[model samples]
Each structure stands twice: as structure tokens, then as C-alpha cells.
Target: MHDPFVPHEMADEAGVHPVTLADLVAQSDIILPHAPATSDAPLMDAGCLATLKRGAVLINAARGALVDGRLPGAGLDVFRQEPPDPSNPLLGMANVFLSDRTAWYP
Candidate 1:
């Protein structure tokens, strides 16, 4: 319900209420990044993570680079690097839930 590229008509047809990305992040209790990744920028970087409501959780079924590892908590199914290095900070965070990238496979 929060895609900038979705046409207004399409959104209306699908009964999706459109909202700005910033507004969605600030208000959502669980943020899901389903958009394609961009090489130049991450969809949810440090600043975006900071705006999340207290104790909010981020769910990234998309590319891992979409999120900054400094978030309060998250459920990640993908990583910027496949088989994230052992030294990755996110691996040590108890608040994070990591899954193999194949999480979406049937």
C-alpha cells in the first residue's frame, strides 16, 4: 500500500491506500521491504531505521542491503552478501532473526 511507482488508478483498483515511504516507515509497526534493490541507495538505511516507532520490527524479504544493521530489531531473509561474514554485526545481535535467503521459496 506504499509504493511510489504504483499508478493511482492501479492503487484504487486494488483497494490499496497509498502513503509516502517516510510516512509508512514512521507509522508502521512492521516494515517490509518488497521493492527491488537500487545500486545507488538502500531503501531503508540508518536514517529510515531511526524513524521507526519504538520496538518496531523490520522484515526484509528483499535484498539485505535495503536495511542498515544498526536497527533495533529485524527479521532478515536476505543479505547484501550471501552467507554473511561471521564478523557481521547483525549476526551477534540478539534482537535480529536471520533466515536463509531461500525463505520465500515454496
Candidate 2:
């Protein structure tokens, strides 16, 4: 898992927190953690989604593939597909916060 989303300066330009995704989910209003590469179900992704307090927002400003694609919840922003499959469950969620694929680009 990547480090917690600490400020770059506190991270000393390369400072990585010793925290896991579970730690961040347990500590913040917004949960931003990476998905494991080899898991078909993306356990961390599912766990974080489940761990989120009800009505919480999930912001995926990175890759959409990290999302489990089959979980249920909201406040989710996923752009793995330019326009995700119409049947994608994430689109139907009310608490989700979706953005076009390019929203995060500079």
C-alpha cells in the first residue's frame, strides 16, 4: 500500500507514512488509497468502501481500475473508462461524486 496522503513537505519530498489503506480509512473524511495489483476483487478497495461511514465520499482521482467494479457505495469518482459501461453500478449510486476522465489532468 502507498503512504497516507501526508503533505509532500512533511513527507520530506519522499516521506512515506508507515500507514496502510486501513489506517487512512480509519482516520479521514476522504479515503484515498491504492488498490492491490494482483487481486481480482481488490480487497483493500472493498474493505475501504465498506469501512467508510455511511454518506461518506470516495474520491478516486487516480485510476478507475482500482475500484472493485462490483462493490456498492457512494462518493465515488472513477474514470477507468472514458465513459464507463452504461450498466456500471457506480453510476447509479446517489452518494458518488463522479468526474470526467480528464478532470484530474494538469
lDDT of each: 0.79, 0.58
Residue 89 Cα positional deviation in candidate 1, in Å, after optimal superposition: 2.3
Query: How does each model score on TM-score?
Result: 0.79, 0.52
Candidate 2 lDDT tens digits, 7-92: 55666656555556666666667656454344445535555666666555555655666666333444545555657888876677
RMSD of 2: 5.6
Which prediction has the highest TM-score against the true structure?
1
Candidate 2's C-alpha runs over 4 A off are 1-17, 34-43, 53-56, 69-77, 102-106
Scanning candidate 1 in windows of ten residues, the lowest lDDT window is 68-77
Clashing pairs in 1: none
Model 1: per-residue lDDT, tens digit, 13-65? 99888988888999998777787777757887788777889878777877777
Q: Name the candidate that leads on lDDT.
A: 1
